[model samples]
Target: MFSRAERKGLRLAGGLTLGFVLCFAGVAAAVLLGHAESGDGGPLLDPYLVRVARFTLWQAALSTLLSVALAIPVARALARQRRFFGRVWLLRLAVVPLGLPALVAALGIVEIWGRQGIVNDLLHLAGLDNPVSVYGLAGILIAHVFFNLPLAARLMLAALDRIAPEHWLTAANLGMRGPALFRLVEWPAIRRVAPGIAGLVFMLCATSFTIVLTLGGGPAATTIEVAIYQALRFDFDPPRAVLLAALQILMTAALLGLIALIGRPDEEGATAGRPIRRFDGRHRRLSDGAILFLFAAFTGAPLIATLTAGLSADLGRLALDPLLHRALATSLAIAFASASLCLLLALPVVMTPRLADRGGTDATTRFLARALPATGSLILLVPPIIIATGWFLILRHFGDTTRHAPAIVAIINALMALPFVVRVLEPAFRTHLARTGRLALSLGVTGANRLLRIDLPALRKPLAMAFAFAMALSLGDLGAIAIFGADGFVTLPWLLFSRMASYRTADAAGIALLLGFLCLLLTLPSASAEPETKGRGNA
Candidate 1:
């Protein structure tokens, strides 16, 4: 527990986090109003964009429902079992999607579900004119299920784990099975987590960018974020871009509101209910085995496809592409710089969270820093293409389009991703500082050296984790790069998109694999950090 000052600081931190999230949500809401004057490419509440939104809504809802629904059975089975071969592996797989880059996953989906991809190739040998449709609505749903099922399973399993072992014993004694067992043991778990899972999957689908873009065949299959991209990047219509940003904001906000209304009624004691027992009967064995197999297929196929393609390819050719190399270097540089920036900013924020509090921050500074991230996010929420267009317009007026635009994109990318870094690192920062503040002061350590010697040693894990996460996110990004990417400022993911558009499946597949591996390498360090660092005091 915090002392009064500490409590005030923690409150401020919460306020700031909420405020930041809400501000972004609000900006996403007024997209229509902002782009009311987006001439030419302006949405004008057009049928095309409306169709896109509707499709996004339908596909995402279905995906969310399927994922959460399927997760119930899978979760229950896992919760009931003891440690088994590949059990931990499956749980880890459930969490792998959490680390998945959307673009990478899309590529894997194509390989498995694409027309000329594996499934289709097999189908062709079987003499089918057309194989499965990995395009349009079908493609979008496949990608979502592929991505969200693991998350839902993980959540549901966590929820079901709450059931007490005694419950299972009592059920056995009473001869409970089937619906009776489900009602007594499962429904409660489902009720507790259903709303949250729904909200998570829904928001994920709603705000989707990469999956919809890659899998979506065209404008007919677009999402709001993609729409914002089209208006700004493709058309350079500021008002339209603003309007789309607003619409996105509103839709995202509405989804979040739904979450709040139907929020996880059972977040507390999610694992309070039961001790997951090993299978003791044929029925139990069958149910558990089926669930494991279903989820394994859902979660494992993408990785297998990616590994097969990536490892089987001409990586040499892919790497030789100058643009690919440039993007790789650029991603690393920005990731490093931004990671440093997050650490610098987070250290202060965590140590002095009171600054975020109305009581602590001066009204003026609070207002300034509080809203500063948007200065960078201005590209996205306001439309990146609009910002680029306005800047381009200014340059054109001055007849100086020669100014470096790619630099601007890199800066924006760093800024846009900064908030995420801050969000992830700030908690660990506060927790550490609050607990170790006196220890550090008593040891007479302060300033830069303090960070390296006193703080960094303890913070090495989260620090590494935050840096890796920021880098991985930045690496997979196409948003900022797209605006300034015209002159070939291509990142690996961008390159893959280009290849896909040009029908270069082989090359695109290779790049996707490379990019996925790169992202995983960057992310693994941080993922590995959490278990290694926490609640430990060091000199």
Candidate 2:
């Protein structure tokens, strides 16, 4: 597909992707080997492990069910009410939670539903003696719903958007009413996408560490991922940690296999005709209005409470605190470093020659092109905590793990962000290359010159968007940081979590606000620059 220099670049890219995958696998293997050598020959299937596994399964299943069920009406209502006031903005707001830090959103959820929160306050005003507690299982479900519901809705909305206008027009012309229209047109679209969305949500909720740690309240609410963290950090039990990590990988692999069987919904592209006016939902205005209002309130209430709670906080003192300043700097540095690494690792894998490109018809080229991106995204199947645990165990054998924590955290964060970076950049890069490859080649533009002149200008926006996304993801991450954070390596999320754990509610709330603001600031550029991609599965 290219001159010798370009082929070399592609080879280097492939090598990088393989090296990353091997590093991850190597760490996990070392952990397992260490566990085997430890001779802690006790049964792995202890009662506690069993209980944690069961709880993890049920919570994830319940969260997925609730998120998907609720998303249906909200997505349908949004699709039907196409031109309502603030509709576009509402859709945009729905996606904000996707990028919102789990810890930030958890704080927001507590502010809304915690015993002393807004809901309880309203109940008290109404003379109701019983106050609600956003803790334990209820709290976990509420937080999961708050995050995943919007994600599910966005995906379903995108599915509805893909329904050709002619289908709607035909439904109207045939006088197909609510259930009939839904049955014939809407249901099929949703069904095609719902399985993938559900599977993704389930995987996310299953691997949840931050929300489970913060809102879990006690051991009864503990998940496998959190249990692994406890085993490694609190108990210093490498054997137990490795076992839990293995269990998580097994469960995730099984779920992925099941989801793969469902297959992905076909990507919807632009139609070459005028938009057809939707008429099936015209008479269901009142019901749709109520659904819209309920979802909007459900999604917005936590954010509102976060803002309100932080208003009374001593911002100046918090801002001036040296520890807070250090954490902020650490977070920014980590975010920048990880995002840069993610781009460096992702670009080559994405830029590799495809099966159909010139001089790329060989099966060897095709296999590598496909396999390389999969390798880049391989971290998605393995939780960040698992990687961190493996490296932590390996490093502890030789030296103080704290000294090496930041580097491990940075590498894991980069890998975690790699999947998203690849997803965002691969399509855009491929499209650009396909459109301009011949022109660039004819102009004798190859290798460094070609990338500098042709690819750079065309891909600048997407690259920026990918970087912003990668940065935001790393900034908000709690998983790798939870494992690697030490006295000198505290990031904002780690600091915020510490304050919350220590019962410094005011300080925690303040930190939460700051962290949320920073993440949102990073995410805005990506959100604004890129056309919204549908169904960012499990990213």
Candidate 3:
């Protein structure tokens, strides 16, 4: 029997389509406002914009090179190592940065690597000055590598896990060791996924704003996003801001284009990769053991420090402040709301193009539609400060900033996190639909029932995971909140910043730890929900 929801597919579809329309409307309105403010001509390019663009790309390239080059040993070690002391703990620890806020991570880095930090303290004890400059390209690189290497290692480890046991066995039988085995097995697999991992990580570093701002400390160290913020906040240069926005679009698009060339396909016919024998050589054993410790320390120490700082923070005093409490409340609300909003906005974009035709999705069109999220991801290209500045100007011109208020911040955060929502959900969505598509059709399954009965159960895991990731992304965001969050619309990170500036280090660290835990809590259900792929068995 057809469920009530199945009968109502048309209505649900319409509502979903409407939501997408509204979401896209906000994007359109923002651009139009920006364009009108710039005058009759298009966004004009200037010398400053050129300089910012060059620095942004240069730093991103350098960071990418360092991150990937460094990740090689870490990834290989994780892949080769199967059992060791706290190895699993190390692997999990490395993923912390992915969910941690950029600002929070920056705080930890400053505490650890700053002039009065451990490194400098040791240097001072040695009879040398604090020669380490933690505020330029070097500082930026340190933070990027810190965050990106663990991630690259994970991706590489996953890639490395796919080697066939037969290949290893045959190599052992043929007395193939060292270089020959690597070329036959390791090389092929790493070659396949390396570009994708590098592209993703590189693009991530390329567009990063918060790390650049906190660690940059100077004009030349600034990225396009940071520069856009400067053009708006410091110089009030609208034209330059717009120019940087356009530049971000161009560069990020080029990066994503490269990603397309290397990423694995996700079509219906795609199967789980064939499995390979897990490595068991003595050399491999030692490599895995060292990898465990290296990645663990690289990823874990900062977190341990942050958590320690947080737990020891004077939260008893901090919470006594009304503003801190208010900011905490606001951050929590926006994080959840933004995540939900992104999911709603993506449904139509994902489902509509397929439902309208019903002849199974056209691969090219589907991929193109998938690109919508990435394209909209350009919001991240322009810093929240820049985006807020533009909107602030546009709103002020209309004689009202109060009217937009928290809604503006919420929308921007939602859109900024939209790409991740779409990307994470696309595969599971397709899988669920493909598995049940024809079955649901003949049964006349339609609306919420169809979604719940056929779609939800099948997609329950991925859907839940997508939501968690979106929430985590939103929670870590610093963009829109930096500007729009003023006047009582503050977020946790904003509050932490205010406290740290006032020398309330204990409070800031406490809030940072709290924020970290909250993100972890949000991430759990989504992750545990997804089933393992074929080649993912313990190596």
Candidate 4:
């Protein structure tokens, strides 16, 4: 339905986005391959690199196991106890970690598990002298579980929720309880989503930078991302950084390929809009309650600790700190720019398919349409640091890359948020077009006229929500910033990490609180809109 200029503009936008990604990939490959160090007739796997890779895989595997293993029972308990007081809020609480900045969550984990933390105080009160050391693999796993368990639980619960109410009713009629009920009814649903969830959790843990960076303590606990960061910034080893980046990309690609091969969850029967009162687990009320209580405490304590610790800091001093002010301003500017860029690029990438449909038999449009979304999401596989490092290598030849930090950081952050933007907008665009395309076409409305009056109105909410989500993701991101951040170009996360690095615990706490609040503020608009979206769906 678009005019020539509108269609051209869409093509131009998609072309530029695709071009940028191709350029990044091309330059990165050239630089990294140019520097690939194969040691004298041997493979490039140095002992140190091997150790780091092994540790990375080991930690990720353990984190995935613990998070998914714990999530199963917690999800089951929450699924069964659907009518308890505050159950709705508790369900909501399970997802709170998804919004939490990694740095903020790490701080909270430290507060609850550090030697000087609440746990140690309780231990001391009990006449125990041994203190918990949350500074190694134990700390990394704890932080990952703290972040991923709720996510796993929420995903598993969604699968459980999809179980047709009739199945539950059938189980109740059959007098099925616990193991028998789970084996026959619930396991299928959980099993359907489990592999996908595990893969997702594994990918997250594997690529995790902020959590591992903070809790890794020293060399023994470093992951590939951390090692890459160290290689570039600390050791100034570009070759090693390139090698690590290549390894990370290959590992992620392999995992993604594996997950794809595993296939999607089989579709289940649809549920009516009726409440599901599960009766099979009635005898486990006390047990379920205990499980939920323990899980909640496990997940919720760090959040409470973060808030309390932040509150205990000198707010007035934090307000007056020049560094904090600069970081906040820098963060907001970068976040807004990143979010805007993400939406701008995402719009065309998502629209390409629809526009291509008009081309009918044209293979080029079809190819462009299919390839753009995957290309946009390709940023996820290649971590921002790798992109930043590649750009760093290219730009350092011209002049100071530090001068280009803001733009570089914003662009990478935008790209990092691209998948999410596409995820949010593609469906809305598709739905809107499916419902309105013919009417608009018949009314002789097309191009800018159709866009401003028709598409914009229908898409405003999703666009705004996408912007907010992208802004939140960029606001909390430390990956790009970690690579490009300089003294003059620090964002909130960068500044927070800097403080924590210099043993400024009090300053770090205050910054974490501020950063968390800003992220939460950006996220709330979308979070609050969920019910409204669901209401529309139900209607």
Candidate 5:
């Protein structure tokens, strides 16, 4: 549909994006490998490293099991009770925790389970001697479940929601109820999604940094991500950090290989779709109610606690704190830059293929088109911390590292958001081009004129929504910043983490509240725009 010049520009832009990904990513990988070969002068598998790896794997496995285990019944309950009051809102609520900053959730968990928090207060009133501590392995499990259970449940619920209405009718007509109904109908739907959801939850828990860092009371509970941070920041041990990053990359690659072998579930058959009419769960209202109540309490407590704790702090004084303002400004700047960069890179990458198909059909163009989108997933294997670590080493080789913190953090955060951005925008762009590309070209609408008059106007909603989601994700990010954050380079999460570390509970609460509020504000626009498009495990 494009004129020759426009298609050429698109191809050029796509090539540049591909080059950007390859050049820097290639350099980062090479640096890490070279460092790994040189060694840290310490034994490769010392007792501490072995212990940390064991704990990391153990916690991830346990967290995955608990999250998926609990999510099954909750998802089943949601699918069964389709017409209940607040059902829509309950599903919306589940998405909130997923978008929320990890530090905020960790703070919320602490408010409910910490030594001087609500549970302890209740125990003291009841004459109990020991207070429940949210400061070790137990705390880690709780935090991981709080973040991942909703994710697993939402994914499973989507699968269950897609079950053909005729299947339910068949089960009901057969007088199938309870275990028999599940065995025949529901189990198959849940089973299809369960493994993929489990793998995602496991990876999330495995790479967990802020949650573990906040809740890991000491070395006894530390994960590899946190250990890497300590190695670089505390011990000033770049060699050790490089080693940990290498180990993490290898571990992640192996897990990804396993998931690839297991493969994704086939897409459900086309059906006469509508809201599920689960007739068999009629005899199980009491049991389903109990299940839902437990799920709500388990998930809702942290949210309620986060708000109550944050509001209980002195708002006036907290607002006036200069450091808070500075962090807020820094975070906003970074988030805005990251979101813009994400779109800038994503738009050309997505556009190149459509432009290519219209103008040319060469093997090189086809290969470039296919490969550009997959570049977004590269971050999965080499996460933000490792990227930051690699860049940290590179900067150290040149000069001061702290000076480049904001730019590096923004770039990494943008890359981290790239996959989601591509998912949201690619479909919108494809549809828009299919509908209007020919008509616009017929009218000689091309180049700057077309983009301003046709493309921007037509694509405003998805663009805005994509921008908001990317900004929210960047605003709450702690991984890249944790590696590069310093006294003058603090963001909201880094500042809150520092406060919590220094025993400033009240200050930390206020920061958490502020950060949470900002993230929520950014999330609303995206959620409203494309609610159905989410919870597909794209994040």
Candidate 6:
């Protein structure tokens, strides 16, 4: 459907994506092979590795099951109560955790459930001798649920919203009530979408880094990602790090493949043009009210604690601290650079011509054109720690890796943000092209002229939104920073984590609140304007 120029654009875009992927793979291979040649090669399946892997799987499974199971009642309650006050705000709050930095959220959790936190303080005031500990397995599970439960509830709530009004009417006419109504109408809706949500949550929990590190408490709670970090950073054992990285990649790939087989939850095509009148859930106000109140409290308590603790912190002193200023400046610089890089990388794939336009193209060309975006998104399957480990090993051979740590971290952060940038930009880019591509072509406009004069102006808003999201994501990331942070290379999350690890709770709480506020501020522009219907069942 395009002139010769468009095809050339497509080819260049495809080549760039392929080259990026190959460069990453090449670095990883070099690291693994280099270590194998020099180190005393032992079997990959050491006892510790085996134990960590088993614990990783076990925790992820339990986390997924709990998040989904708990989401059911919350979602069902929201679905039935249609016109309650503050409902929209409540829904918006459910998405706040998605944008929060894991470490910030972990700090928030600690402020609520730690030994000196509100819960334990209340218990002590009541003359109870027992106090709570927000560390170890309990801490990990609580943090995971705090982050993932709202996501699961939102997805399940969206599924419930999709059920037809006709079905509800039929059930009512048949005198269906309570268990019977759920059996006939609700269960099927949840079942259809539950598998995909479970898999997504499982993958997330399995690859968890910041939460695991913050709450792990000891070696018994170590995850594969943490093990890889220890092998490289603490032991200086590249061979072992490489082995663990390879295992993580293999396990994640398997989970992703299984998710594909189960199919994605139906997230698109939600209609808000008309309202549905519901016949059920009219007489169960007491139960539904209790459910809603409990979940709201569960999700809201930590955030409230964070805010209260942060309010009591000495912000004036923190402002004058050189370390905080340096870390803040570094984080801003990295966020800006990474956001720009991600947009540049995502544009080509987003602008690739659709396959339907390949009227005269050969099969191979069409296939490559279609595969380019998939390749870009496939970067998600390779955990950021794995990429960082590979590059860290490679840089060690040439010189001190510390010198290049910040730059390396920025690149990995950009790559991790690529999938989100693509998701945000692709739809808007495609829609703009569908409207203007033929017109621009007919006017003999192509390449820079078309992009500058037509596409850019029309897509300015979405492009900005994508940039903001990418920037926020990079700013909050701990994965790459965890591997690279050192004396002269501290970022905000790194500094905050150090404070928390050293038992400087007051300073940590201040930094956590600051980081959380920054992320929320960056996310507001997009969140306010975007429709709630999009990405309904997606985490």
For lDDT, the strongest prediction is 5
Clashing pairs in 5: none
TM match of model 5 to true structure? 0.94
Question: Tens-digit lDDT track for model 5 on 136-166?
Answer: 9999999999989988888888888777888
**C-alpha RMSD by candidate, in order:** 5.7, 2.3, 4.4, 2.8, 2.3, 2.4
lDDT of 2: 0.84
lDDT of 6 at 515: 91
Candidate 2 structure quality by residue, lDDT tens digits, 1-539: 36667776686677666777677767666776678578568896889999999999999999999999999999999888887787877777787787789999999898889988889999999999988878899999999999999889888887887777778887888999978889998998899888899988998898899999999999999999999899878998888888888888898888878887888677654555657478966788889999999999999988887877777789999988999999999889989999998899887777764533655355656777767877786776788888888888788787777787877787889888888888888888878877998788788888788888888999998899889888888999999989878787899999999999988989988998988888888776456321133434345
Off by over 4 Å in 2: 126-128, 266-272, 353-367, 528-539
Query: Candidate 6: what lDDT?
Result: 0.82
| Order by lDDT, highest first | 5, 4, 2, 6, 3, 1
Worst 10 residues of 6 by lDDT: 530-539
What is the Cα-based TM-score of model 2?
0.95
Off by over 4 Å in 4: 1-8, 37-43, 270-274, 357-359, 528-539
Worst 10 residues of 3 by lDDT: 530-539
lDDT by residue (1-539, candidate 3, tens digit) is 22445424533553554545445445544763566476647536657677777887788888888888877777766665565566666666666777788878877887777786777788888999746877898889888988898777777676666554566666777887678877876777777766777787788888788888778988878788887677766786666666666677678777777777776722222333555445445667766666666667657767777877887888787769787778777777877887788778766556544543444544544544444444445554444454565566666676656566567677667777766676677766776777787787787876666767877788776677777787777777777666554564678877776676677777788888878888878765444321132333110
- Over 4 Å off, model 3: 1-46, 126-128, 262-280, 284-288, 356-389, 400-403, 524-539
Model 4, residue pairs in steric clash = none
Whole-model lDDT per candidate: 0.65, 0.84, 0.68, 0.85, 0.85, 0.82
Q: What is model 4's C-alpha RMSD?
A: 2.8
RMSD of 2: 2.3
Write the residue-wise lDDT of candidate 6 on 259-353 in tens digits: 98998655433344455566766787789889888888878888887877777789889989999999999999999998998888787666664
